[model samples]
Target: MNVAHFEGAGAPPRKRPWTAPGALVVRALGNAAAAAPVEGAMLRFGRGRPGDPGKPVDVTVGVDDTKVSRQHGLLVHRSGWWHLSNTGRLPIEVGNHVLQPNGDAVPLRAGVTSALISTADRRHLVELCVNGSEGASPAPAFGLHTAPGHVWRLDERERLVLAVLGQEYLRNNPRAQPLARHQAAAQLAELRPGEDWDVRKMDRVVEAVRLRLSGQGVFGLVQSDLPQPIGNLLSHNLLTELAVTTSSLTSADLMRLEGAD
Candidate 1:
């Protein structure tokens, strides 16, 4: 008598190892609700399925969308920041930066950042949130004081331009986003009918502010610091820094714009 044995079913499937001290949380925004804490060095995202060739993505972004490639993009943890890299045919919108296929990875700031994948008919969004380590010390507030020289310096005209461009942020709006140049220009024209305020003038004023801040050791204010198709990245970064670190733009300034409207 003899016993029959299975040909190749001896061992269990190998489980993916979980890295200690999770660093990031990735959540897909849509009908498909998939959320996971990234405990490893990288988190892959795409429309891939299990048992596919090569390494499959960790998260399914556009499950039902045929346009989304199987291995669309990935988030890599490096140097205390999460960098997003797009490897799909279409571009991925991260904040104001559009990550083209095979482009350089863009480092995401702390807090929640929305990444969008757009198709002809619909849009897919993924939310990435980098968590600070438990018991970690608060970040130092360098040059974030109310002292005269410590705060960012802006002339009257420059302040007005930034006030208009960053009104939403100054209002503490949770959904605040940087305003377009045209919108800011139109608002400025209303605020100061005598002074000529067009897109070109607004561009110059903002550029001057950025140059000044960049000289002060502020990064991401210059074009070279950001990826191509910058969109509103400069404005977003500038406004966020101004809103949190300096009194260059305030609620009174926003009220001035509101009073005009």
Candidate 2:
């Protein structure tokens, strides 16, 4: 008796076969919650269909989402760091950095990093966690009076300006966003009417902080590191870093501004 056979045909595949014990873990957030380990040097992500035999991606991000390309992007382990590279038409937001399609790879710092993949209708979040590994450094410390050691010090004026700019986050606003330059300036003026505070001064002060932080290895502070129409990208990134990594800004800061004449 002769048995028909196919070259690649085999037993049913194991669930999340790509996953294994490794230093890097990539898990999709939300209902799908598909996860895989970066056992190899690289892992690809893209749109995946429910029951397609073909290997769409190592990790599935969106199903039947036209916006997500078949081979959207990848996570590559190189030089002891997992860097995210976007290969699709749309951009991928990883923490404060937005990785544009075909753009340069951005290193993912140690610990949990949130990456957002947006489709036509909704947004899909993928969490990339890099466990302790060689050459992997902890996220930078930019907090005042909170960090255990090695804090990114800010002058009095810089601290005040940042506090005003990040008041929304300090207030625990769910829809928090960095305040506009003019708005922040206005608040600072109200907070200290004697001192000169305007758009120009606000820009200078914020720029100084951004430059200092960027020089200290913080990502997403420089214009070239972000896309155009930056809007609040600089302030947003700075404030986010401050909000998460430090107690540099707090509700009391906001109360001070509000209570001011």
Candidate 3:
């Protein structure tokens, strides 16, 4: 008996994510879904009731989402990445946390993305995507604060996760955006050894941390008001509420990361 094998049947290299310039995409994440601004230029989103006289914005939202203001949000391409800023009377959520009208900007990634913003009445689910991360890094924010009664701490992998989140991919780097699961897994894999962690466990890691924070009586997760992804909520809380920036892992934690303990 004989068997035939292809000489070049080896696994091909993983293809890198590439992006086109001046491209940003947005989609609705709620019951009724849609995309706006196309994905090529700067655009604005607004709403007009059935009888409102003003011209519709770049993306004319239907009267269904009354929460969307006349000029709800903006999509801008700056520095090296696409930025989403809320310019309406209400907050524009990019993920776990809502972006205040005058709040820090959140960088958009590629493909379909979901954000929850609200109006005087209800919340709206919207999505914005970019071609890819394209090496986009957020401005790093590192801080440590301790009071007589309140204190925050980070474990080993959490430190690494925050480090990846704080990476500066955008010029105006606002707050640290949570890393994608694969990105977090890759970054965590580099930081620690001996405990082979898989990307599959990223949610567990983040959720555990979230539950721990909840145990500490932290209400930051409620900011979104909607039960959503844990990682985004946790990252937003850590950066905005707890200020967990930089690699907070100390020598002891570093020992665990190096598996020298």
- Best-matching candidate per TM-score: 2
Better of 1 and 3 by TM-score: 1
Positional deviation of 62 in candidate 2, in angstroms?
11
Candidate 3 residue pairs that clash: 109-130, 110-130, 113-127, 137-168, 137-169
Candidate 2: tens digits of C-alpha lDDT, residues 215-257:
9888778987654556666788788777755666667767876
* Whole-model Cα lDDT of every candidate shown, in order: 0.68, 0.66, 0.49
lDDT of 1 by residue, 1-261 (tens): 011111221211122111113245565632121122333366677887433678576556788898998888877765555678998988998865568899888886555577899999988887665544442113336778665634676788888898889888898874467887788898889879889889999999888889888998777888877556677778888997787556667888778768874
Sort by lDDT, best first: 1, 2, 3
Clashing pairs in 1: none
Candidate 2 displacement at residue 188 in angstroms: 1.8
User: Model 3, which residues run further than 4 Å from truth?
Assistant: 1-22, 29-40, 49-55, 133-261
lDDT of 1: 0.68
Candidate 3, residues 98-132, lDDT tens digits: the string is 58887666665345456666666676655454543
Query: What TM-score does prediction 2 earn?
Result: 0.53
Q: Give the candidate number with the greatest lDDT.
A: 1
Q: Give per-model TM-scores.
A: 0.50, 0.53, 0.39
**Candidate 2 clashing pairs?**
none
